[model samples]
Target: MSYKAIYTYAWDLQEAGVPAAVDEFRRLGLDTVTVAGSYHAGKFLRPRGTRGKVYFPEDGTVYFHADPARYGTIQPLANSLLAEGDVLGELTRSDMATNVWLVLLHNTRLGMAHPESVVRNAFGDPYFYNLCPSAPDARAYAVALASDVTERYPVSGISLEAPGWTPYAHGFHHEFALLKSNAWLENLLGLCFCEHCLASAERAGIDARRLKAQIASDIEAYLESGIDYPADMAEAFWRADLAGDFELQSFLDFRCGVVTSLVGEIRDAVRADATVSVIPSVARPTAGAWYEGSDLPALAQTAGIIEACFYEASAERVSADLFDLQRRLRGAGKLRGILRPSYPDLASKTEFLGAVQALRNGGVEEVAFYNWGFLPQDNLAWIGDAMRELG
Candidate 1:
């Protein structure tokens, strides 16, 4: 049978009651419920929330109970609601298969607490939201979190999000930028030159100091020039620019090596029964993965599955993305596509069904929706309708 699932949050299930939510999921023709196990803070406007319309999650917390002994310099804080009762534990008890959605290496609370362990750009500006994967404590914390949840709960699998470097344009609280932002500028600013990163690159035979100095100099020159790079040509320009720079390309590859190794460690740590999957990049079109150090082919070997977030508007775009990703993966591992069936992606049931059809036609057997809390009642109906029609 084809696998179908819905991405959701534990808070949403708790609000609707676990049994009721399970029934609703089944009603929507979903076989799995992917709930947030560990996540960063977000101001979510819950359309289906009964208690309130807007909810702000506690920053950098886990929904499941985490064992303190399993952690290191960085530790996870349990969501206060976990004190009332374990939402994840309750979900695991249900007939529906449960998958833990873990946002690793992107914790603002932990990053701020351990500034030395976070990602620092070429100019030494620390991104408090992104914990450098090369840091020993960060790696340890990620592995422990993955293993701890799988060991305690009988989850079918774990979906790893933000397991690699995050880009510069992430939606931070009141993020303000007056200068015209382009891909080249963001990528340069997002490059991590932290102590751990530098040491890792050095060990891998890269001239870490010289590379950092060159990057800093180039960024300074770009800023001084005030070049208004066209948005259409930005990505192409960046790639061509990287092609000419061998040292920079090697550094990016080293970064991917860092992420791939960390994922392999997490895979080894988790229970043997649970499948490991990585959401390679949150970037659209999926090709922008390298900017965040997510190499699809490398991750395909390390991870059991690659959950590509195809957050596009039309079926044509979705098909094009699927084709490109499959070509890149070269059949190394299983590929799954995630689609948003709500506004800005799929406006009607026909569009949602078309996207599903596009994936199915592209040889993707598993399809997952974005979230249960964010979608409206009609969108849920559209999902059920799509599932039935496809089956």
Candidate 2:
């Protein structure tokens, strides 16, 4: 499986326009609702220069049907009409909201507490900063934290965004060292370098030395693709296409084993049957060979659905059908592709239609726009009718 050829399914959604949002979903004739992970208005409330208060409350608050303000409080599953498909706040049971997927921001309280639960390298230290799944403290924190979120919210799925497996994601090699083992401080300095990691790897017969070499190699791979390498690595991991080469299955096994352990624990603790999904950023080596080690086969092993992010305007740069072609390599029927509005301020109806037309023809079953917050209401009329007719 080289590139995951995606099937058109549905588009991303948000708690926009209240009841009108559902009407928009209907008008568009979309079948699925995709809520982004940690997309909230109350968050950071303001961007760099903005002064006015964020008009919409953070989606985390009521989107999950939970009172988002209180961290520990669990709201009653009060809304009888709330169904998973209601990406907007006011979903009714009668709306037939079905097959909705909510995106979750993944991280244990320990991730916040220890800050180092995520892997990082700062100064000259080679640290194990990633949340140590095998560690008792990490496990306890993960179980409690995930349980708290799901129990507090009314989500149908969890999207692991902040878990930071790739080592190239945001805050990669974050400067989060909590321990100061001289040997670890000198080397083996990442977050998971805690006592638990050493003991677990020893028990599992995982050669710590070998793991170190792999980390060095993988970090270099990330850097080769222009992704910043963690500070501690000796060399760069070569940048390759996220949609790998012929030996994809081997990498898939490793990815499945590695990522699955993290996600599986969350599902085991929170929603066991959570509809897990993956959406890799288009920022990395979309054009490179099998370097990023995406391993769609491996992703498929752990995920309920896999979505690849292709900016709506991508069609203009390449053939319109390229994204669909990418999806086709997966060979799995569960793969889906997502599209966002080309522009944040306003959408070009022509581009929307063209992209969708291309995606549909490319064998995709669904497409989604970013958020309702900025999408012009007038354009909503155009989208509703256009989307409904796609399938």
Candidate 3:
């Protein structure tokens, strides 16, 4: 079943501006191409290229796009590369399956416009960069957006990334850089205390307010003083000897529930024939996995495919991570390994081939390259070589 694929930014297709890009994929011996459908709002610094704004489109989507009559406001970027070219059509014609990749809950546009739905820190600060999954508007928007892409395009599958909540430590800009590094403290500092989360915790019979106050106080103290607390504070806070808090554990469980529920909704929103795949972060057991609401077991129940990401790591490390994630998700469904064969990880063909072989041995049926645009032209043929060896 060798299902080899490559991920490409929509801008890459726009820049290439030729039907022959399909030929390039054919030469690489790739069977699938996943294109970025609706992405986050940011300024990406392309290689040797001018920076461009990544945003929600006014076209290509059946919903969530600009509609002056229905929304009373039209999004500025009405024309996009997806709507302008026949790239999707061409890829389909070339006998390659196309998947529309969607990023959820990471939109700065909606988060900034509707601050009410943004994630709130324990210190009462709102991170206007991340949309709250528990927010009704944000949930509805994500579902509608996923449905629109599947309904309007000829995509064979729907790939969901960042479908859950984000950490508070993100989007702090230069402030985050200046702070000291402490995994346990960073994890605690990343917790969210938004209104929706708080209300849900209350309904679940958990004292979210008390936990929030304690967290705020501890975090504030840690910031003010260089004194280090217990090394296992993040995980041990629930222990009887430490904080003896069961309600705090319940609060964490509530966050995971929110994420699981969102994945289920997105699965139902897409077309029945298309597969729903999710990408969750890879973290150590010492670091709580449910913090970002990425419960593999629960989410796997709703999703058809689990595209485990093992990016920016060595071949042996990628092998270890892929195997561990495979064990966790294997009982649920198929596994697709995503990798980066370019800088910071591999410098030669031996490393790339070793990684590909490791992925196959680790029970990965499909392997998707990190991206086509980020890697140089010379590095692409390695994909073909690996696929040939595997075949």
- What would the TM-score be for candidate 2 when compared with the true structure? 0.57
> How well is each residue in 1-391 modelled by candidate 3, as lDDT tens digits?
2457898766677667536667788788888888776665444434433344342233222211432332212122233553576565555556788887777777666566778887887887887767788877778777766776677566788788877766544553345456555655666666778898788888988899898998889778878897655656634543542245577668778888898888898888788888888876544431235668888877778786777777644678777776667667658867777877777666578888898999888767688986787666667778888889988
Query: Candidate 2, after superposition: displacement of residue 315 in Å?
Result: 1.5
The residue ranges of model 2 lying beyond 4 angstroms of the native Cα positions read 1-17, 36-110, 122-169, 172-256, 264-275, 280-294, 316-329, 344-347, 378-382, 388-391
User: Candidate 2's residue-wise lDDT over 1-391, tens digit each?
Assistant: 1121111111122222334445556556554444432331222222211234244332322234544333322221222224545433333232523333332223322244454343333222322324444444444543444455456544444444432232323322224544322211222223233344444445555554345455556544543555433443322212232134322234323433544465556556765544555553323333321222234544545555556555535456324335533654466525555555536322577766666666667666645554444344555455564565563
* Model 1: number of backbone collisions: 0
**Model 1 clashing residue pairs (backbone):** none
Could you tell which candidate, 1 or 3, scores higher by TM-score?
1
Candidate 1, 1-391: lDDT as tens digits? 3458899988888889999999998998899989999999899988889999999999999999889999998989889898788888998899899999999988999999999999999989889999999999999999999999999899999999998889989835788877788888788888899999999999999998898998899889878896877887877878887989888888999999999999999999999989888999978889878778888988988988999998988888888999999999999889988999988887777778899999999999898999899998988889899889877
Query: How many residue pairs clash in each candidate at the backbone level?
Result: 0, 52, 0
TM-score of candidate 3 versus the correct structure, residues matched by position? 0.86
- Candidate 3 runs further than 4 Å off: 41-83, 86-94, 169-177, 228-244, 282-289
How well does model 2 score by local distance difference test? 0.41
Which scores higher on lDDT, 1 or 2?
A: 1
Model 2, residue 256: C-alpha shift (Å): 4.9
Residue 319 displacement in candidate 3 (angstroms): 1.9
- Judged by lDDT, which candidate is best? 1
Clashing pairs in 3: none
In model 2, how large is the Cα lDDT of residue 273?
Answer: 49
Candidate 1 lDDT at 97 equals 91
Per lDDT, what order, best first? 1, 3, 2
